[model samples]
Target: MSLKREVLYQKWRPKLFSDVMGQDHITVTLKNSLLRNRYAHAYLFTGPRGVGKTSTARILAKALNLEIDEHGEPKIDSKISEEIDKGKFLDLIEIDAASNRRIDDIRSLLDNVQFMPSSGKYKVYIIDEVHMLTNEAFNALLKTLEEPPPQVIMILATTEYQKLPETIVSRCQRFDFRNVSNSEVVKRLKVIAEHEKIQCKEEILWFIAENSSGSLRDACNLLEQLSIAFDEITISKARELFGIIDENISLKIYKMIIENNISELIETLQDLRLRGIDFKSLSNSLIDVLRLGIFTVNGATEIQGYSSDFIKNTSLVFSGSDSRKLITILEKFIEMISIRTEHFDPLLDSAIIHLTYMFENKRIIKEELNQTQEKEIKSPLNIDTQNQNKNIETSENNIKESKINDTQSHEKGLEVNQISKPKLDSNEKQDWEKVLFDLRRAKFGKMVLGALLRNVEIPKKLDEKLVLKFKSKSLHDHFKVEWQLELAREAVKKAVTKVYGNGIKLVLEEPDEEQKNNTKANLLESDIVKSALAMGAKVEEEKEG
Candidate 1:
């Protein structure tokens, strides 16, 4: 029988401080401390997983006990050093706090910490995922950390440093590790590929690096899987194995959107569906491409992975203003994806179709606004309470102007028909109340529209436009849907006709961070939230949409 081979991540683990990649700050500091013989008794290593926290702890252990050169490099050929490398050193203890997270376990370790090293000069203990320890275990360990034995060195590693007790964190010397950058990850992978004699395309390394999200261990594992699956690793094999959508497909999708080729776009989407392409991954890839495009348009140079021709085409397609709009669109899409639990196919299709005609829609809306501004009709029943006489016509034009002539609306069967209006005074507040009341009292689909606009900021009579400022994004996003927005626009115009008259555009403003926080505070103080709080329900803060 053949001997089992060591995994690349394990085999390629760094043995010296200089061997650690993308953590020069921590490595250099640790090396300095080792050279000066001033290393701390208790150390805390915290960062995202697979970023060499454990490996660094092991290296620190070897450095503290083993013989080192003038540059603080441990002599790995020594018997004790070899034992540490193979995880068989008696003085170096490795504990998985996730599995052994009890007061008894901690007490047992503390008992061992008081004893002198069997062979080495100092006893080294590495506790990984230390945040998983219970409160009792943490309390038990705190005293030892506060006054540790002179010969004992404890290294605690955790991915979630926030969960660690402040007392424990304050007692230890902390070192934070950061995610390895893609370029650095690529270089490291290339080094491993050359050493391992793996014949793989360079793109395959980038593919692995991109997917690993800066975790070198993840990148190495992915590359190892691909290397094992094929004699010579290829991009197609890696992508197919991982179910990753090809960048070329994403590039084609972008081109289709830029060209507004709905027919071809739909055809391509259908083909992707037939080929079992993951829409979620495709969305992410498009977002990456859009980000690169934005950077390339904004004077960034030497961008990798994308060809020069692709960069030139991207720059030609997007201006500074278009780049901002693209960011907004991407944000909205990401928000939609996070909030909704539905499948990605429909959302992907909707986003692509919307982006395809977004330019045309903006152009049409601008032209309509200009025409409305140029041609104004006199109002038949003008009640000017502000003493500012303005030529404002009926809001019939505003209602139709807000509707986008697109297939999405037609498919949804949405239409804005004229509704009988009740005459109102020129007071904007009264007009808002009356409009909201009409929406609530009307025998329509649900009272959703009224509930959505209950807390909206009402414009003043002096205001030329009827701006609808929502308190929260949930309400704003719901109201900003094409069909819902048109419906609300139609109703608000009809109700506020006496105040603003014609050429009054209905605007929806996205709330700022301050507004969102203020609104959230207000909601928390409401009776409903109070009741939930009384029922032992805690409100955790969520990410901004």
Candidate 2:
């Protein structure tokens, strides 16, 4: 006998309103609407991916048009349900705006929507990624979507609700499909684990649930991926597969940052990069652990996955304010991870413990601001008009004076990022390391160009130009590449001006004329090239004639 095989996600996909997880409020409302026989003409199901926007639409569609049994309950027609689930129902139309986002597509859809249902009571139209539609397409869709025939029901689904026009959103009953909560995800995963007979640790299930970031679809997908690797999944197997950092390592990093141990923090981050852990994942895990620490410190027990000893130890690492600050910084770091794929050195350069005391600075500034506002509020009427005018004038003068001072400093080559067309002073020179670090620390390139620079070591300075000799020709050739060369030059100049108080020229070795012509000579030996040459081929020269 052949064993049945199916994807875990597809096999356990919800077929009924009650079967949907982490969306009781939505499902309950949907069930109530069906129970009352109150049908909405259109619905805008908006939320993050995998929380069942499309799935719920199918369930709602089935409920709306399902054949009824004697008891008045919607009869379970497996074939029809399967068709709807597969988006193949004759009356159920599924349009992906990502592919068919043109006005013509919307017009075609509008033309077809006028017709009545062939099989059931209602014809359901599901438009996925509706936000991707062009403005003209949206205009064409507006009339149809707003006032479709009573028998026709439209379900518009989108991950980005904000991308949808307010005009469209206003016309339909909007239902937000929130990301599945971690607990709900965990509960569902546990059920699947038991069904699959995969005896995994509770922590493994929680880890999978947590990592999915509230997308139940993502959770299901992750569960399926794990299933491929393990008959009985363990936490270690999951961690290694996911490249999750150890608890001890996480604690150490957090502790080091909180303690303002910049060097240690940088070293730790470098080691993490060496191990090839995804920075995005590592950052997320750090945020989770810190959040857990906060809850632990506050004596909140609702969230699980942290032992008392672990929590207690973590709780001691940071105060309430410190924890909040660290969380904010980590959140920012998490966001930055999406912009670029960071290598080892760039990761350190991008992140450091230098700003660990930011909380104190912010707190002090807040206190000063509050005090000033309080004073102004208390004694506002007491001041004479003349004094008030004088005070205003003084404040304005102070602002002007500060601006002038900044301009002067920039002129004197004191400010690094001065954009005032400032000139470099002859007295100053570039601190190559610090300037390079500063340039790399900010957003520079898509890849870690700064990391590559760090590998090149200190550059040799020749009066007007700085000559950087890479250990190998490949590294040298990277700078010579058309796109990288200019950006590299700009970065080098910026660093030179910042450290040495002026931009310096970048000098690189050029390939010899013989070497450039060698490629053409080599290509002539090939049979194809020989035939092309004999036929008077217009073989392109390396440089312009």
Candidate 3:
């Protein structure tokens, strides 16, 4: 019978330090230690999956047992190295801490520490996934790691260095490996293709590298699958075979986002789903695109795997501040996919809608802030009551001129309708009270204009115009915004028309200190406030400087 084919990952695994990809810092340190004859008794290798921690451990074992030259240079015996690689060498013991993580298994392993090497000068123990060991197992092994026999070398490898006990970690010499870069993964895959005599395109290699997420083993496995499935790998074939969400599709989706085209985005997503494209794969691709776009906008140049045109076109759609917001929003959408997929379409659409509103709200708030800053710079601490009364007509004219041809100039026309009264009569005061009381039926703002008008006297005729004097500039300013102004005008006009069939045209004004103080004192001593105070309510007086 024919033997099954060995996978590329195992068949083409790096057997030498020089063959290791994207880990020069780690490999160089270990080589230097070997050259100087200063190797540690116990070594710890930590990194993410498929970054070759276990493979490096095997290389270190080979360095320990390999024959040497007169210059102390280690020469690997391929036969013995192959035996160790296959876990057949009696002197080289390998442990899968994940399955044999119990303290009893650990104790059984440690009991063999006293025995001598069967063939080589040293016995090597390689423990994979060391963090899987239980607390008792770790405690049992700590002393041995700290004081192993001169002939025994312990090599511990794990993906999660943080989960390993500090006591165990401190006892061993630790080497940290980084995730392999895309370019390095591509380079190694290219070597595999040439060695295996496979026909693969450059874009196909990039697709494999991207989908691998920086794991060399995963990239090799992907390549192996593709090589077995197809005689030659093409871009379209790779997309179809692996359900790869092509960059063009991602770019089109980004264009929809930029244009706020929700309908097109949904349709495209649905079509892609119908074509058997994986939503998770598409999400991953989109995350990469968004990250690249952010990098492009901030003038960051570290990211790759996308074209410059793609980055520039996507990044140009947003400003720097907006790009950050978009990235935050996109990250949230990506997170939602992992939590739940049932409501993905509607949820993503809703998120996009909210993002558009957020952009508009930020613009409005910034404009308001600027207008407020300008107003604060010009407004002063105090105003004379008489001068304010004099300036009211002229300032009203300026405001009117700035507005459209509205009925504001019609305030002068009201003079012909009035009977030239000097003081407000009881009937007119009742009319003002009716206006304030009826505002509840026509309210438009949060602050009740009725309650605020209580701090001011009833409307009094002042020359040609009727004046509404508020106790403070703050109160007057609060009601000075266009919406508040319109609300007050409509309420008063409607109430007067309803009560007496005619209303006096009026303007709001702020009282001077003397009148303001008098009005405040009258309000405090009013029947309601006095009744509350008589019922045991305390009033705190302001201590003015």
* TM-scores, all models, native as reference: 0.65, 0.60, 0.65
Per-residue lDDT value at 300 in model 2: 66
Global lDDT scores for all candidate models: 0.73, 0.66, 0.70
* lDDT per residue (tens digit) for residues 1-545 in model 2: 66966688888888877678989889878777777777689999998888999888888888888764433335566677777767678988888999999999989888887788888888889999999999999888888888888889999999898988899999999998888888888898888878877677777778888678788878888778888887877777887877766676777776776656667878878777787766666666666667776666666655575666777777776544444455667677667566654373466345655555543333444465687688779887464899856654553332211111112222222111101111222122124545544555433433344544543435544344444444333334443442233444455556566654553444343334454344344433457743443333333442322
> In model 1, what lDDT does residue 259 have?
61
Model 3 CA lDDT for position 477: 46
Looking at model 1, report the run of 10 residues with the lowest lDDT sum.
401-410
Please write out the lDDT profile of model 3 over residues 1-545, one tens digit for every residue: 76966789999777788777888998888888888889899999999999889888888888889964443435666677778778798988999999999999999999999999988879999999999999999999988989999899999999999999899989999998998999999999999999899898776888789888789999999898888888968777877877777777776776666555667767886787677676666667777776766776777644566556756666665443456466776778678667665766556545544554435534544466677678778994575889877665554453211121135442332111212113444455655655655653344554455555555556665433455655454445444642235545566566645654443445455556564554343445357654543343333432222
The 10 consecutive residues of candidate 3 with the worst lDDT sum are 412-421
TM-score of 3: 0.65
**Model 3: residues >4 Å from true position, as ranges?**
68-73, 272-277, 299-303, 312-321, 330-346, 358-545
Tens-place lDDT per residue, model 1, 1-545, is 86967899999999988888889999989988988988898999999878899999888888888878888878777888788888999999999999999999999999888788999999998999999999999999998998999999999999999999999999999999999888888899999999999998787787788899889999999988888889977777888888988776887887777666789999999999999887888888888877877787678765776657767766665643356567777787677666555666887788788887755543444465566556555334455755422223443333332322222332343233232232333244545655654455332232345544665666433234455655555445445552344454455455556345655544455566665546444554457744543333334442433
Ranking by lDDT: 1, 3, 2
Candidate 2 ranges with C-alpha deviation above 4 Å: 1-5, 67-73, 77-79, 258-264, 299-302, 319-350, 355-545
